[model samples]
Target: MKGFTSYAIKNLKSTGSIARSSKFLARNLAKQVPTDAKTIVELGAGDGIITRELLKYMPQQAHLTSYEISEELLALLQRIDHPRFSLKHSSAMDIVQDFAIDSVDCLVSCLPLALFPLEMKHELLTHIRSVLKPNGLFLQYQYWLSDKQLIKEYFPHLKTNWVPLNLPPSFVYTGTAPNSELVAE
Candidate 1:
């Protein structure tokens, strides 16, 4: 977490933020997780800041699997030793290969979708839809509201919350999955 700025600077395309998420931003996102949730997935878990916050608010029985592509960040995430917590050193795109379809109760993402190309974003959103149960929760944060229309294609019941406490501020998007399943394109 100490070197977040440098890591983000070096890996802007993936890391996406120069600062570790503030507690305010983390809390805002965590509050949306269902209290009865059993399985939770975190995408692009850089620095494990948000991951830690989720652990605090989640039900004790809930298991959290955090995915990170950066080896260095994965090493940082490995420092967490909760029995309900696990880490995957893989891309979010490979989520279907790692978890069963319609198996997850909720998903919290910091994947920097705005930085990704439209097609790739579509694939990621599709994977998110594929893994979540009907009306499952999908939470993501961005510096802008640019992806709302795109995400609407996947999650029909989408809502946005503003967290100005974060550096440069952040917009948290909460989406409820449609009943229909999604296939990777």
Candidate 2:
């Protein structure tokens, strides 16, 4: 995955993981996805590493839509040619406008939240909350725990786990979009 490293260096601010270390693959996705998930979304799907892993574990009938803002990565992702995959050239915040509300069952993100400006992170989470089905899952990994409080703001019921096998290690944050009525007036 030389191309992946090159892209990561060139887009350090946008790229989070040093590499898609195989060690985290099982822990990242295997047990998280519900067996019946119909519609899943992936944010910051760089070079489709996690995207491909997600596909391998997803139920055959489930469809996954991955969003990548970088055209360079999007080109590589589009070539995967999976029948259940849909690649979107957009930012995570655009999901609300790009898809129907309450339509997504799960969202796995590789976004570098700690590197983002506070407002952009907040705005993205707002849109994420809007598009997810009630109690939908948002699984994300970061190299640091600084964003723990930020994630808690958007997803109240949250837990974190550590995966040391990855380069530089990583923390996996699992959260659920609160049931819609709980957040509504």
Candidate 3:
């Protein structure tokens, strides 16, 4: 636990917490992962804590693709040993390169959007919108509410839940994809 916390602090941008996420938070985030989902993707899957929690809800036939930018943490995630789990060493910003349009059923993101620059945030949201199915779910947890309006621009049906069990408390954002045709029309 000590070493993991050190790693998380060292990589705050990716891990987004001083301590690893509590199982309570993990459970709350994973709760929305329906058993019927075929593909689940995780961004900044720190130490695979949430990664493991996600697996418990995943159907055996489902595949989970996790992206972890911290090389040190990648070693921990590799120990997952699940037949359907795969790890990628890349940033979520480049997700479009690896996936086709409307490919992801759910994207569980641990990225710290609050710390991102405005332009980078826009780029990330655009890339995120590209990969999600029209009905796809986007789950994100943050310590601040500053970015809610920005996210609403892309995901019109955004809602939130607050989890005070974490070390610093957090807000979980659940959003449905925006209607592109609504904009086009």
Candidate 4:
């Protein structure tokens, strides 16, 4: 299996809380983000691992905006230099106010939900839903299954699938807003 170099993997491993997803997991997560999404936002884009995969499959006209808290990682993404890609060196919570409500086409995340405080997790979901278009999709991957209930509570139309091909396995959860009018209104 192709894997990140030892040094790269080591950095991820040392993070303790942040899991550096395997390439398989990254590809699977990318697939969950709608390829046709006009304005896609990715949260916690560590090392641009999933960012690269998302770019590979995204529509040419799609605009991909990725937010990463790590300055080092943001620097790496800057080197990619794709016209369709924008890297933001900021935390997700810090930028939610920047976009208008109900304007996002899709939101994809590689953040470690389990590591977040319960209140923060809920607030993030609520904010994400508020900004997403009515028919918008929220795609997230986790290393464990415990967060399923939390996700379901916020996204009633949640759908989940497992990908065992990844190291230590992973689960992809997709939440679709029920109706465009209801979401935007």
Candidate 5:
């Protein structure tokens, strides 16, 4: 079983701490992030796959900060050493407390939300809300739809889109502040 897991990890390009996300899903999530955003934060930045795409799409003047729980992936990112990118070797849940309140223009997460316990999810979402700018967006992609209610409860004004091109398909949930609403059908 260990050998099989290792084989799967090698082929899937996934570390034990991160999920293997499809390129299609990454593109869709990238589109949701505003290119003009000044300060962007990425949660669960595994292997820097989405990080590479974000740097490609984000404006040159923008600053991109990423958090990765895995020391291996964090070390790997440091080796690439992009000037516009800053990586934190920490858990996504600690982002709000680590950074100043309302300092982030956007929050993009590729976290495996379904794996987290309910209390942890709620706490993270609360922290995310506290740190985000009033007009900022919080984008999260998940493989399952079971957590839709949990998302809606935390982010009352939320917009959801499905990207079927992903390996296992995925849902992108974009959350906005109370007074804002996305014009998605």
Candidate 6:
């Protein structure tokens, strides 16, 4: 609760910020979060490092909704006073029920998707796809490619990029939801 590093170390398994060394990664991640996005949701908002960076770049009309189940991390996130920012003590899977379908412009996830159980991971990805706008962006970072195929199932248009500056390094996966009309055809 004291800081990003302390909270991450104390709750290593649950906290997504394994290392307080994501400065460069956060910057790049923030850059990818559509600036014109009217609504943005961030999953696993670890201590608001990336959230803070997002505030700096998001358009004046944009709003960032961050989700963090860890109270310790949430406390730090709450300290970031910004009119355009909001925090949710919830999980990514609830997104569909929490927001309207096709409402989100971008969803940035720092969650350890590879570690999630297969069924839960699929469920969450499904929810993400349902809540995203037709042209929405799904930006997720992970240390491994275990969830690559699962993500592909939900978002056929996908690209992967490496962020070597992050601690332990990570891959940034950018994806867009598949067109429902095309799938139906």
| Best-matching candidate per TM-score | 1
Rank candidates by lDDT, best first: 1, 3, 6, 2, 4, 5
> How would you encode candidate 3's per-residue C-alpha lDDT over 18-92 as one tens digit per residue?
898889889898888867788899998888889999998777678999998877888888889988898999888
lDDT (Cα, tens digit) per residue for candidate 5, span 1-185: 23323433664433322335667777777777776688899998876778887887887688889998766566656765688888888888788677787778889987778877888888888788777877788899877787888888767777888988765678899987544432211
Clashes (N, CA, C under 3 Å) per candidate:
0, 0, 0, 0, 0, 0
- lDDT by residue (1-185, candidate 2, tens digit) is 35887778777777865565454754476468878889999888888778888888998779999999988888888888889999889888889988788888888988888898988888888888878888888888888899988888888888999888777788888889887543421
Model 4: weakest 10-residue lDDT segment is 1-10
Stretches of candidate 3 above 4 Å error?
181-185
In the order shown, what is each candidate's alpha-carbon RMSD? 1.7, 2.2, 2.2, 4.0, 5.1, 2.3
Which portions of model 5 miss their true places by more than 4 Å? Answer: 1-19, 179-185
Estimate candidate 4's alpha-carbon lDDT, on a 0 to 1 scale.
Answer: 0.76
C-alpha positional error of residue 109 in candidate 2 after TM-score superposition, expressed in Å: 0.9
The digit string of per-residue lDDT tens for model 4 on 1-185 reads 12234434566542323345678877877776676688888998876778988888787778889988766666667877788998888889755676788888888977778777898888888778877888789898876888888887767788888888766688899998655333221
Candidate 4: stretches off by over 4 Å:
1-19, 180-185
> On residues 1-185, what C-alpha lDDT tens digit does candidate 6 reach at each position?
45677767777777644687487888878888776789999999877878988888787899999998877777878889999888899877778878999999999988888777888887788788888999799999888787887788787888999999988798899998765832311
TM-score per candidate, chains pooled:
0.95, 0.91, 0.93, 0.85, 0.84, 0.92
Q: Which of 3 and 4 is ahead in TM-score?
A: 3
Clashing pairs in 2: none
lDDT of 6 at 107: 92
Give me candidate 6's TM-score against the actual structure. Answer: 0.92
> Mind giving the per-residue lDDT tens digits that candidate 1 earns over 16-38?
78778998999898888999999
Q: Evaluate all candidate structures by whole-model CA lDDT and list the values in order.
A: 0.88, 0.81, 0.85, 0.76, 0.75, 0.83
4 versus 6: better TM-score goes to: 6
